[model samples]
Target: MLRGVCTALAAVSATGALMACRSPHEPAPLTVRVDAGSVRGIAKGEARQFLGIPYAQPPTGALRWTLPREPRPWSGVKDVGKPGKDCAQGSPGPKNPSSEDCLYVNVTAPREHHGSLPVMVWLHGGGFTQGSGKDYDAVRLATEGKAVVVTVNYRLGMFGYLGLPGLAGSGDFGFADQIAALRWARRNASAFGGDPRNVTVFGQSAGAMSTCALLTSPAARGLFDKAVISSGSCGLRWPAGGLFPGAPADRPYVPVAQGQDDGLAAAEELDCTGAGALACLRGKTTAELLPHSPSFADHLAYGTRLLPRDPAVALRAGAFAHVPVLIGGTRDEARSFVAGAIQYDPELITARTYPRLLKEAFGRHAGRVAARYPLSRFPSAGLAWATVLTDASWACSTLAGARDLAARTTVYSYEFADEDAPNVNGLHVPDVPQGAAHATDLPYLFDLGGRDLLVNRERKGLARTMVGYWSAFARTGDPNHRGAPRWRPGTAPLSLAPGAIRTVDAAAEHDCGFWATTAR
Candidate 1:
């Protein structure tokens, strides 16, 4: 059952005059009737927020690892004043608790908007193992952009993506959940003062990968009018000897056979092997499953009805939804990942060990990689390593995907180059500058981390510009609007820096020419 606090008030009258009195009360509920039921949200400033609204029945017991089921209709008003518990995963913090029954979506809309505004649905990123939609506050997007915003919560790790044989639609339940949320939005957006037909799906990192997957999935066609992908691409793959060390360098999706192999291993570890393995696995408690959850390296299985082929392969073959796309990555995308490693082991990286590490990461191409990214050129071997992976794994790969997508529809690319962007909560490394790292662009788009981080005039201006571009794109297919810099479609990407937005030849900037010849 849902948990929250409510206060009762008493009315006093004298001489036919009445006044209501209470000591610090909750905001009056703002009720809206949706297809499933009536829900009461809370009003805060210019935005009305409906939090913890379930889009599907809880995926627990027999339903675990299966496609999401539609939530049952409710007879009375459902209280959605508080955020829902995040899907069961690694700890986000002490305050953000998680549960197996998490499949909620939060809506934030302008309190005094007129009829039929555009809708922007958000998907959070945590390598498909962590993060919740509640991590982002859409009030700034709803109030400033004048559009309705919806943030979704999907299953994570073992409960969400484990692929065992005989389980229908295994390893892709998380993707199914996202599609369900989009379907829900199409049916009920009008009740939240949003246009059902006009919707945009946007996300960063793993969330961005999910967006890319949806673009390629036949099941997700017609769900969204436009798409935005940040710091991720369908073509992104980390080679065995590359940035992620021992992990395989193939594309993100695993085949069904590999998924079943993983499932068998997990079952053996849990002592649930044999004919009744599926039943025994499902009967395990949350605590029993938490320690055995798969890492980020575990991937959603492809070649199913939902995704007939790999996302990159499907995109290149023109087998994806023909929708306008905004795709790009950060200028220094690998710094955050590399810096974290350096912090863990101070002696982990050094100038003398640079060439050896490169050989271990790049194999025969290590010599070429070492020549291009010499340790003498960078402040530390760690920075040099990050630069190589940033160009090869992120920038060049995303550009290749964008070129393929451009052939079918309008595709606009960008690179976040905020060299001095404020350090956000996660991805923090002591004494190392983040330099527009993986998720640094998040604060500019949403009031994430904290408002104080954006108090500076320059940061505030950039945030407004980003919001304008995002909302404008949701309204129309294009991100260009009046007052903002004109964004044009081309191979060159628009550089998003503090107080600056201009097109740059990102291929040349990141040395994609060298990577194209050497790396995958």
Candidate 2:
């Protein structure tokens, strides 16, 4: 059963009409009909938000680890005014908790809309172990961009990515859930005043990886007209100790065999390794299963129907869908990850330790890497290490992916380069400049934590510019429109900074040439 809502009324205008601003996990009051049934939502300012409309039935009990089934048809107006619980993952504090019964999509459209507007569906990023669709409030995107926005939540970690030996949806249940949501949006977009034919699927980080998977999946063809990938790339790879002081090398995807191996190992740890193990695994409580979630992170598997091959392999073979793609990443991409490690152990990346760290990760190439990014060239050793990883793992890899994608389709690449971009992740290390690090570009496109963090007028203006660029892309296949800077399609990514938005040689600046000679 769905949870009950606690309502708090807020006056919309001076006319004194109250709008119930309830918890996202609870239901709301306005009604709209879809294929499955009718669902009621809330009138939140400029957007009429259909919070927590189930796209697929909850993935629990007998359904866990299997493909997502279509949502069961409902009778009357299902009160979805309240948002649905987030996917069972490591997300926020207990106040806004996560749950296993999460397979919902929140529709945000103009409160006063003439039907048939373009649709933009969002997939949130939290590695593969954390985060939710609700964390991003799409009011800015809905009203400012004048588009219907859909934010989705899919299963995560063990519940979503676990690949049993002969499971029906091995290694890619989360991918299936995303495809199902897109199918739902395509079917019911007109009910929410959105055009059924025009759809844009965009995401960042893990969400970006999901979008990449969608582009390569035959099952996802025709679901979206265009695609946007941010802070994640088809060729994204991490070297040994690239993420932290001593972390192992990693990539966003693994083979289905590897995924199955990971799942089998996890099941053994849970003592559910015999026949009918899925049923036995499902019998465990949320608390009992969560500790093993991290083990399944970044485990989106290939060699399955949903993803026949790795996205990078598909990109190289030009096997992906031929659609316009907007792909980019922040400037100082790996600063947060490095800073987080230094935060835990303050002396983790000092001058003496930095050289040893690089040698451990890169072996003979350590000398070459250190020669390019000396501590003398940076404010501190931590920043130096971050710069090396950022250029090699993030900026250069994304640029390569963009070039590969552009070989077949229209691809508009960009680099978010705001020097004072807010540290949205809250990871702070003294002397570490968070210059547009990782997800800092998110606030420019969204209001994180339901609060607008653009305190400065200049930053807020940049936010509007970003929203304009994104919405324009959603409306047409191109992001270029009147009043915005000319964003041409090619290899060079448009550098996005206040008063400095223009094409930049990200390869030159990030030293991709040096990395081209080095192992990624």
Candidate 3:
């Protein structure tokens, strides 16, 4: 119904051109013909944006939990003026919309580009439970970096990663959707003036974890030429008394048998049993299914034909895509989590409960952890706890993964160290001085909802530098460019702070030696 109205307006405007008359000063209409059909996009400044382009058929009803298939070719021009609905998940914000039919990708390209430009495909992060590709506006990256950018939407939660026994390839539907999007990009990038062979896949947090998974996934071997993993790594194993106790810190991969067991338990709880279980499950409404679905943050089943082994294990064996990788995390990644805990329970910041908390988290290594991260050293017990976990779970583990990746291919590591980086909206918790915490670097590249907060000259410069480095990496495998400082690989990670960008020994700075010893 909505599309019909748009099509009627297009037909009235002109015979073939699906756009209203505009002033001569205005930019021309943006349209690109792809495999499925021709899509009409919007022109903003010097960039052409095609939003909400479906790469696969809707994964709803009988198609639920199944691998994504190519979207049926449409006869008329598709109106890609706005973003499509995000995959079904808990509401990320009051304004965010989601649905089951959410396998879409958005493309942004420079309007004045000559030949094919490098393409950067982005994946959003929300712990695999929330977030949509539309949250990021890539106009800045497209115009300033002189590259074509693609943001993607894949299924989340039960719709994306339900691991039932009867349903083959159930848990990996999201990964498959991503691969399908890449295949679409490979086939249609030329329409948008993008080089399919020079595609770079980049993401942050859970998105970065997905990128790491793609590196090891047999199905994604040749889909991307390079990768940028931010604030996440694939080699981390949940430590005994670490940030997420009992959870795997690496790219969480569950065995097929374990996944099937969990799926059966979930089905039993939902009262969907016997031969009609899948039918019953699929028939349930979104409201009924949301409360019963397992936590989306849990690991997906690996060791299948799609993903043959754990990502970390596969990386160690050099059984992954040998693409150049840029990997790193923020300096105080755990501060935000610790600040939230302290806000909920003030006793978490008290010295009296510090050792007890350490014991609860560290198990047998409490004493050693306490000695290394004493309460006297930090401003508060919360800061100390945050520091310890930052080293153990994030910094050291990520560096370890970088080293392994470096052994096989070129690797560039970095640490965002701007202690007073502006906190993004929804993350500005009171009393929490988010010191370049997890995902703080997002604003430096994409113009998110809180782009105005980074208005200062220094922050703007950093954003420009980051965009340059990222775009340069997309153009070539290396991130080096003129005007920016020389970014050496694997020797010392480049420290990115306001007004300063240079190399620093992140391993020594984060006390990786102690973490490495304890991790082993």
Candidate 4:
């Protein structure tokens, strides 16, 4: 059973009345007949929204650990008035309950246009542990960008990612769920007046990691033409995290004594080993084990066909899908993660500790990496740490992915630098201002019907520009527009994280310099 959240319906103006009516007994709203069922959605001011449409069969009992099954045919039109319950995971803040039956999608489209429009499919980030497609609404993005926007809910946590011995495979099942959702879009997007052929997959944080995985996996090769990864990097499979296969005692970072077991080990601890592991886990109740769910970074399973090796290795070997990509990171990308590491104050980030941690993770390259981004050049210890981490984790990873892809594909790179990007959530450290922190770019790309505490009017204008660029990219592989500045692919090392808006040639003016400066 799915849990319910807040629900309300607002009226539309006379000029837009036709877009909001759903039936003759009521009004004529946006009506679309999907393959599994039909939906009637109302126009919410600028955009028409259809919410809570299931894309796959509910994974219950015997269906657990198995691949997603096709959604069952419904007898009548489904009421898609409210967004579905998020995947079965704890919310970051005060929100809703978690459940196992959350494989649904929500779509928003422009009102005036009728033919097949470009579509942007969103995959929410929670490190494959938390977050929901419903948490984000696509009103602003669809209306302003004039493209159909789709947000999806995929499996998460142990239910979604656990790779037991008896399970089907030893990789990311959460990612598999997303691929299934995209398949759903390819099959039924035309009903919503969207062009299935022109699809773009995008996400932030853990969602970005998922995007990177999709780019390399053969299963997701033809699903999307373009991708946008924000604030997450690939490579570095720590033994402690359990994504890779190396002896726990062989790695210094492994804290096996801390009870941080990998999915395999966790299953063993639960007395579930070998082929019957799926059945063993299914017998347990949701309440009996959730209080002790694994951390977001804990890798449920890997070393499978879906992910033959780490994504960074795949990107370097040129084994990924050859698709045009837009990759970027915020100025203060790691502040959120830093904030979560309490007791480790900004002042505590010394030259000794910084290099020590880096050495442990990077080994021989630690000194070289540290030299490129020394703490001595920054304003404060926190700022220096944030800069290096943002660059190393997000900026550099994106640059590497873009540069490698550019050898055979088109790749544009960026670094968002808006400092006062309203972070009223108090999630980041006070010293580490949002400064285009992790996910600040999302609101500008899509209008979810409410003001994100981190945005205002000036920011809203920036949002329009950003959405315009994204929409153009969805329409055509290129992100160029009539009035906007020309976007060039990052082909060289110096141009990886170029200033905010550097022109492909002279005759144009953009803010590429601002991005490059903060990035450095």
Candidate 5:
């Protein structure tokens, strides 16, 4: 069997460093010994699942504001067959049920093992507000890809993110949680039939932004060999005296010409102030802190010491991790963001709102980008509006990130344009058809357990095609092979626009001119 050959090779290379093999038992169940304790996971047909393993101590009570501490080891083999309680959150739908003690990682491995398979660590996205790894099931990723799949949960919102003056260091805790999880995998994954040397960190939306942040963070170097960033890419924008876009790089770190909001004053407005700020925050419950969590305009994912001032700046300066990367976004990434951006009114999208929105999001280049993406070019103003938003925020950032990495890393870019693919969320309205909107490609990556999402009949091939590409990438840096169309790595993205998906080679895709003309 494929697994037998791989395990034999692995055993030979490992020199019996791991647990002793069966004196010949009927395919021993996949298991591992982690720092927290030992876990014996069950194998379901083809997938081996180990759920709810803590990567760090529960950050509850006095432990709230401090960096994560190592989880205490357990005395016996814990039954991690089921997931732990999702972090104490606000609500179920809009906001997840989150708690201060939420820090866990779930691992799934293929039943049959090739000694140490590549491990893919996933970070779920919810604007850093709501989302849980528990919502995702990794059975398919493990079996089909012949890889080890790990999903993690980190602190969120006020419990995970509120940056107060006398508290912990600026911006991170959540990212640090991710790093801790990776460290655990580095030390223990081998026992679970995974390669410690070959790790890939991948995520979407805020998760993707977090992964990109890891590329430049000093704390995360050498933890992974490759990265995959989908959708949201972040940078600094300001609203107050605190860190904002345009704050002078020398004294204060922020992006230029981005915005002019008083960040510190705004945090103060949210009641995050003073020396005991951390202590006060720790005393508050998840429910009490919900209202204070930044949303809409106040939400800032970039601009902080942890994020290193500016990602693009660091990337251009070649100050980021030199690793293989796959960066891309859906064709209509902003339709979901539109619910909040336009106050739920699709009709509000116009030449006026379009330009204003651009200005609010991109500063000076707003008008130029508005001109380049005038609503007159599309069937409806709403369509054009959505296009511009997705292209500028998701597509543009994705391509630019790839371009920046091109100098020191192998960068491959793509755009998901499977029009018939079903929208993954119920937010789709009569006015807005969620054509390959954000995260629509996720179900294609994993089995999604039992959750059903849009998958057109003909497009089923596309999902398999994507999984093949992704699994190949996890094993090897390059994402090209048989069973899928030839893919070429380039500084620019290979367009998935409309009908035929074209692989852009040495020549730049339309993105080069799109970004150049859009940038003032």
Candidate 6:
């Protein structure tokens, strides 16, 4: 078997750990003992899936707004065949129920036991507001990639990210949970036939944003060796009305003081003010605090012990962890956002309102911006506005951040350019053809919502190619091997599509030079 011979030699690490090969006479075990307890997972096709093992204690009551602690040990074998409830969310849908006791990690590995296989840890994307590690099925990533893949569930919204004044772990409870997951991975990976030393942390959307925070956070040092950031670089910024019609100009993170102020506001609204506000807030039921959750959506704070400054600033000053990075976003990244805005108010942005929208976003540079991205080039006003945001806010910011990372460390930037990419977003507009928008690249790598989004053979082939690229990257820092085209890091991204994968001149294509002058 491949695990017995080929992987035996490949499993050798710098520290000279024991070989990851299974002895020919030894049988694979159905149950494994981890730090917490013995867990028995199911055999999922060609992979072993251990689902919903707690890495941290539940952050309920006195634990709210505090750093994560190691899980209390158990005495008996735990059945981890199914996922736990996702962290308590602001919006718990019929399909996606959640709870506060949701700090679980799911592990998927090739069925054949290989002790030294590379590790890929996935952090899910839901705007730091909602999402669970269970939402992504990583069996393919584990079996095909020949790696151990772990998807994590961290606290979400106010439950995970409250920055009360004088609080100890202000604005970093969520990030702390991620670090704790890494700690668990490091401690238990070898038992799962994974190389803890060769872990690569990757995520999309707000998960990607958290990965950005992970790179810049002092407390997260040595947790992982490589990073894959998708769609949510620290440098990504939305101008006023760029995200949606009335959305404010913002980045994912805020100042600590700002977060504290929002926290206090929540306290006053809930009538939990004064010296014991933290305790009072903690004592409130989850239902009582759900409404104020959205306010902390993009409010991960800086100037705290976890993150000293903005990750964008940290990258510019070369203060981030010196790890190889794979970063980029989809081509038409903002069509989904604009499409949603138009869905709410069909007349919110027509030909008549497009110019006014530009003025509100770009201010003095509105005319120049209009001239550069004219309505004649696009199908509808919403599509045109989406293009403006795709270029100015999404593409350019990602490219610039990639450039910064390449200057400091190795970077392989890519743009998932399949125009007919699957719409994993689940938001549809008759006018907006979701062509490679935002998280459309996700399904190419992960089976999102526990279902494969790729339907056709060509897209499935592209998914295979992407898995090859990603798994190879997980195996080694560089994502290059035979049978795939060469991927080089530079200012622009390597375009990822079904048949025509190649390099692209993104600055010229996106009018980044014009936005460079106009951007605030």
In terms of TM-score, the best-performing candidate is: 6
After superposition, which runs of candidate 6 have C-alpha atoms over 4 Å from their true positions?
A: 1-21, 24-28, 92-96
Q: State each model's CA lDDT, in order.
A: 0.81, 0.86, 0.79, 0.64, 0.66, 0.86
- Over all chains combined, what TM-score does candidate 3 have? 0.91
Ten residues in a row with the worst lDDT in model 2?
Answer: 11-20
- RMSD (CA, angstroms), candidate 2: 7.3
lDDT of 3 at 180: 86
- lDDT (C-alpha) at residue 220 in model 1: 92
Against the hidden true structure, what lDDT does model 2 obtain? Answer: 0.86
Tell me the lDDT of model 2 at 167: 89
Candidate 3, residues 429-461, lDDT tens digits: the string is 444577888877888898884144577899989
Q: How close is candidate 4 to the true structure, as a TM-score?
A: 0.80
| TM-score, structure 6 vs. true | 0.95
Regions more than 4 Å wrong, model 5: 1-31, 92-96, 234-273, 295-306, 339-343, 350-371, 452-457, 495-501, 504-514, 517-520
RMSD of 5: 5.6
Question: Where is model 3 more than 4 Å wrong at Cα?
Answer: 1-29, 91-96, 240-251, 425-432
Cα distance off (Å), candidate 2, residue 363: 2.0
Better of 1 and 6 by lDDT: 6
For model 1, the run of ten residues with the poorest summed lDDT: 13-22
lDDT of 3: 0.79
lDDT of 1 by residue, 230-349 (tens): 988998877653545444565567887787788788878899988988899989988788776755243777878787788888989998999999999899888887777777666656
lDDT of model 5, residue 400: 67
Name the Cα RMSD for model 1. 7.3
Compute the lDDT of residue 41 as modeled in candidate 6: 88
